[model samples]
Target: MALFSARRGSGLAAWLLAGSLACLLLVLVDASRMAEERTRERAHGRALVARVGLTDLALFNEARYTRHLSQADRHAAFQDHPGALEHFPAGSLAGPARPSP
Candidate 1:
């Protein structure tokens, strides 16, 4: 009876140890995968920001060109008819007004 009990106790301890090791390994693998995912997310965020910045630069260039053209047109209009400005409204020289929502 004593021998049987000792053998049973040893078997139980081995089983518990194996289960604990398995759980530890699983946790380690999950943690590693999470770390990799975070790294990928950060890279994607950086790429997105770069793309947005490039788009903003292009828009800024286009706006600058439009502004230059509007200024030129105003100058030409005033030069062509000096008295025409006095007959027009106050905001007439500012180009077409933006439509309200």
Candidate 2:
């Protein structure tokens, strides 16, 4: 007598498919619930911005040049020397600042 039979109809594949479907359903349900909450949060954020007048979002805390991309100077990253390599990790991730019109 074999401990496990090769012809056994355990339906393991069906069970895995059903489990994945259940998880997907839970994610969709959670997203629907959060949609309403996000709308309210966005409105609150807008009101706060209007009242406090917030500045640009800080992208990286590593260096001053990488902190605010909009206000960052292109040459600020090369403070050490003109041909010096970027010391900050965030500097490589961020592209050059947009030219002012």
Candidate 3:
């Protein structure tokens, strides 16, 4: 009476096929994870660049406004004073409206 099966090759082939399938699944999962991580990093980098651009624009506008105010002033652009120069305080000249003596 034979207790064990005589065929051994078929079992080995089935095990090898299962192992290969598992390895392929793992590789595909790892590849997809790496792709998703790269996409997320790219989006973060784009947002960082946009934030920097916005900050630069805000700074440029502020500088332009300050220059316009200085040019419109009667003290800085023209270097002229109202009435007497002795009545005004020293180094405080900033606007068109003069301080009354």
| Model 2 score (lDDT) | 0.71
Each candidate structure's TM-score, on Cα atoms with residue i matched to residue i, is 0.35, 0.62, 0.34
Q: Write the per-residue lDDT of candidate 3 for residues 1-101, one digit (tens) a residue.
A: 13232356666676678789999999998998999999998897679878775332222222332344433345443345543342234233333445459
Which of the numbered candidates is closest to the native, going by highest TM-score? 2
Q: Write down the RMSD of candidate 1 (Cα, Å).
A: 19.5
Stretches of model 1 off by over 4 angstroms after superposition = 1-7, 44-101
Off by over 4 Å in 3: 1-7, 44-101
Worst 10-residue stretch by lDDT in candidate 2? 1-10
| Residue ranges of candidate 2 with Cα displaced over 4 Å | 1-10, 78-84, 98-101
Model 3 residue 74 lDDT? 50
Q: Against the true structure, candidate 3 has what lDDT?
A: 0.53
Preferred candidate (TM-score higher): 2 or 3: 2
What does candidate 2 score on TM? 0.62
How does candidate 1 score on lDDT?
0.54
Give the CA lDDT, 0 to 100, for residue 80 in model 2. 68
Ten residues in a row with the worst lDDT in model 3? 54-63
By lDDT rank, best first, the candidates go 2, 1, 3
